[model samples]
Every structure is written in structure tokens, then in C-alpha cells.
Target: MKSSGKRGTRSFGAVELLPTWHWSQFTFFTMVDHNGNESSAPYFILIGLPGLERAQFWLAFPLCSLYLIAVLGNLTIIYIVRTEHSLHEPMYIFLCMLSGLDVLISTSSMPKMMAIFWFNSTTIQFDACLLQMFAIHSLSGMESTVLLAMAFDRYVAICHPLRHATVLTLPRVAKIGMAAVVRGAALMAPLPVFIKRLPFCGSNILSHSYCLHQDVMKLACADIHVNIIYGLIVIVSAIGLDSLLISLSYLLILKTVLGLTREAQTKAFGTCVSHVCAVFIFYVPFIGLSMVHRFGTQHDSLLPVIMANIYLLVPPVLNPIVYGVKTKEIRQRILRLFHVTTQTSDP
Candidate 1:
């Protein structure tokens, strides 16, 4: 029997004939050689799995639409905060930071996802993939940190109204926001560095819509036990523990509110209710993703795609609407800004 072997693109033929039984053994042994010696090559793979063509189409269309709305909505918030001097308070400044972060978080992954859906191009450069992973996580971590700061802002304002001005001054708020951004970037940047160093000897296809750390690390050739542990620690600290502290801050605020007059209590709770809702919507999906990834079936990929988009996009789109409508000052300011623009544009 003639034996054939493939090394990269070049094929080698047997110089001497072997018995059929020996050829079978040779094929098995040579397969290990192919696995060990194969060089990496880029290939286009569908973002979603096979048999999910319709699912991909349906998911991509709404995701693209949501991403656009998120971008425009967050931009409007930033513009409003920057151009309107009367809105220059600690609350609105934090809101501006949140809007900026939302824009970064949503745009980070959505554009690439839309590209994959529209063009059927899922081949990401190794460096680009690493950058994308780092950016998404960094922005997400920043958002969480910003939210915690916002909670503290609210806590001080409601619980200690007289000291609010001195406590959250412009310089102080700016410093806090900058620190949050720096902290987030510093914490998340190392993850991608570690991930990129691992050898990817298997299929390069990413199972999820975006370059998630968990999904990308699954392609590693060597052991990932330590990486997974480190990831869990990061997630627990950045997201899980942050959420807990925010919750505790709110709980203290609730106790303080309860001791006040009915009218004051009502006003305070109303101010925070929108933020509470926004936080819940933002974090529930994240917690779900973590739980599912750790304890549930990893092969079920749709859960994560849906959860990721919801966590990233929904809050950005809804935040402006929720806070703008709920707060009388912000609502009137938005209307006044629009009215002035309309008058200025009249011919």
C-alpha cells in the first residue's frame, strides 16, 4: 500500500510500499505529526455555529439597530452635558462620564459584530482580537466603577445635603472619574497580554459574537486552569464585589431616607429609583453570563450573545430616557435645549 503524508501545504509520498495493516498504523502515527507541526493559518469561520443561519440574521439586525440607538443616545447626553453650563453639577458630570463610557462599550463590540453579520467575515487578526477583548472589558469595568462612584455621589447628596458641594467638587469629581478609567484599563489590559501568549493550535473560530475573554481562551492549546481562575477573580472583584458595594450604599441611603419626612423620602427615593433600575438591568445579564459560563453548558452559545448585547447596549439607550424623564430639571433642560435649537434653525 502507498502511504501519503501532509506537512503544511506540501505532501510527501512513501518511497517503499507497506502492507495494508502497517499503512493503517502509519496513518495514525503520522496524524500526530501533522497536529504537532502544523502552522497557524487564518480562515473565515461563521460567527455563529452551523444550522444557525436564520438565528444569526435575526440577531444581527436588531443588534445593529440597537447599537446605532445606543451611540446616538449616549452622544446626545454627552453633548447636552458639555454645552449646557447650568447642568454642570456632580450628578450631570458623572452622567456625562457614564455616557462616554457607554459609547465606548457599545461601539467596541457592536461594530465588529455587525461586520461579521453583514460581510460574513469572522477572521480577526490576532492583535485586533486581543485589542478588542481588552477594550470591551476595560470599558465595562470602568462603567461599573463609575456607577459605584455615582452611588456614592447620590449617597452624599441625599444623606448629607449640606456637604454635597464640598464633597463632590469639580476637581474631585474629575479626579475620581479619571481614577476609575485608569484603574479599569490597568486591571483589564493584563488579561489580553496573557491570552495572546497562549498557543492556539485548534480551530480559530470564536463561538460568540464578540471577542470575549472566556470564548477566546477556549482556543488555547496548553492548560488554561490558571487563566480561568484569574479571570474569575477579576470578574468577581470588578463586577460581583462592585455590585455588592453599590447595593450596600443604596441600602444605607434607604435607611436614611426612611427616617426623613414622607415628602423628602419620596423625592429621594424617586431620584434614585431610575439609577437602581438601570443598575439592575446592567448587572443581571452579567451575573447570568458568569453563572452560565461557570456552571451551565458552554456549548449553548446563544445565551451569552443575547446577554452580552443586552448588558452592553440596553443600559446606554435606556439610561438617558430613564433619568431624563424621571428628573424634572433634566427633562426641562432637554426640552429647552431642543426648543432653542428649533428656533435658531427657523428660516
Candidate 2:
């Protein structure tokens, strides 16, 4: 096999293979040998940001601060929901579940990103990279399902007020949560496995500070049509379908609210404002990132990386704050919790 030695170009018998995409401009390839054996990197590098490489060290502080806030805020939500018997309703139950998923989603991607930015420890083992990818996408899907369940809870509370208790009993809510877990896990399980089977004979430096299935798949030298198709299927089945259902539920809710008295309408819509904010926070960045990855390759590469990181971090950091501020029960409980703590610690 002859070698061109430009961007690690190598001859695979009769075919001369150039690296894939513009990202190959950033790094060299270490591809398969003449025997078609896997010579891919056992570890991958996470370059934080493409255009702003010089500022990445300083960027770590804000990212780390956001991660800390996400963890603390979500934990407080969980603590309040668990301790306050009044919040044992289906709505708060789903909120608690969402908080848990938020924590998982941010934690899965942030620590490694912090390492890359703070210490430049960017090398991640192939297996560990795959694990992070699974955790992030799976938890994100589960969060979508949980949000859907919360929308349903709101629908029942506002539209079918008398039937709310009977319709969404604790057992049913628990079953819904379990289904979210199973569906998210089962659908995303093949993603990492598919990447594992593909021969990654190119630059293993990922586009973002994290390992996404889409980002990792692009590095593979083999035909990736299957990966692309399966990725779309997962998105459609999980986020896309869930989003449509949640929207439909809200439409029905709107109709119900329109028929109510003005005071009642205000009260009903107020209840959903936090959830609406949460939904937008999760989906906007997610869809933007997806579009940038699929369609905006010609645009600045930094757009996708920024959108991906926002998709991962924004919902977690903002959801808790939205709920704490918008939901009356949660806000009061948080205040009470602080009041008690302050009194207990007084000198």
C-alpha cells in the first residue's frame, strides 16, 4: 500500500482514502492496514472548542460553575420533593424524575469536558467514550419521556380535573417512569454497539468536548448509512414523537383553559409555564444541534459544538431554577427549607 502522507492519507489496496469531512483538517488519520484489520485509536482526544481554542482554558470556569449549579439545584429539587408529602402528586413526581435525569445528563458530559479544559487531559479510552455517549443520549431521551408524562399530568389536572387522581395514580406514574427507562435504554443500546462494530480508521479526535454517537460515527472509515438511519429512527421515535404528543396535550389543555373563567385560565396557564420553559430549553438546543450537524457543515464548526454543549448543559441548569421560581409549591418549600436551616444554625 502506498501512502501520500498528507492528512494521513493511505492506500487501501486499490482505493486511496482521504480523511472524512473538514474536521480531518484539524488532525491526522490512523486507519486500517492492508489486511483490513482495525488500527483505530484505543483512545480519543476531546478538543474543547474549534475556533476559540485560545479561550478554552478560561471557558472552563463558567462551564464548571454551571455544572455545580445544575447539580445543586437538581439535588435540592429531589430533596424537597422527597421530604414534602404534599409534593407526592404525579406532577412533582415527574418533576423529580426530570431533575434526576438533568443531573445525569450534565454529569455524564461535564467532568470529562472539565478535564479537557482545566488540565488538557483530553485522552479518553474507546470504551469510556462509548459509555459517556450512551449515558448522555439515553438520559436525554428519558428526560423527554418524563417531560411528556408531566404534560399528561398537567392535561389531566386542567382538562380532566375530576379524573386526575384516578387517571394518574402512583402505581401508574411509577409504571410510566419504568417505561421511560426501558424505552430510552433499549432504543439507544444499539448506538454504541454499532459504533463499536464499525472500523474507525481515521482521526479519533471528536468534534466536541464529549462523545456523541453522531460525532463518533463520522470518524469511522466504513459505510455509515446504517448508523445515520438508526440515529434518525431513535430521534423520531424518542424526542420527535414525544414532542408532538406533548404539543397535542397542550393544545387540548388550551382548549380546556379557554372555556374557564379568566381567573381560572390564569391559574391553569401559570401551572404550565415552568413546564413550557423546560420543554423549550430541552428541545431548542437539541434540534438546533441536530440541524447544525446534519445540514450546517458548511457553516462554522463551532456552531454545532456550542449547540451541543448548550443542549447538554442548559436544561439541567435552568430547569431547576424555572421550577423553583415558577411553581408556587416548590418555591414556598424551598424558602421554608432555607428558613429552617438558618434558624437551626443561628449562634
Best by TM-score: 2
lDDT of 1 by residue, 1-347 (tens): 33454323333331222112221121111112333453322321326533466567676787788778878877887888888888899888988898898888888877777777776666677777888889988998998988898899899999899999999999999999999999899889888887866766555666566787887877677788877988988888888888989999999999999999999989999889877876886788777777766665655456766666676778888888887788677788789888999999999
Clashes of each: 0, 0
lDDT winner: 2
TM-scores vs. true structure, each candidate? 0.85, 0.90
- What is the lDDT of every predicted structure here? 0.75, 0.88
How far out, in Å, is residue 89 in model 2? 0.5
> What's the TM for model 1?
0.85
Q: Per-residue lDDT of 1-347 in model 2, one digit per residue for the tens?
A: 76656565777664445555435355444555545566656677787887776799998999999999999999999999999999999999999999999999998989889888888787798999999999988998899999999999999999999999999999999999999999899999999999888877657778788999988998888999999999999999999999999999999999999999999999999999999999999999999888888887643477778888899899999999999999999999999999999999999
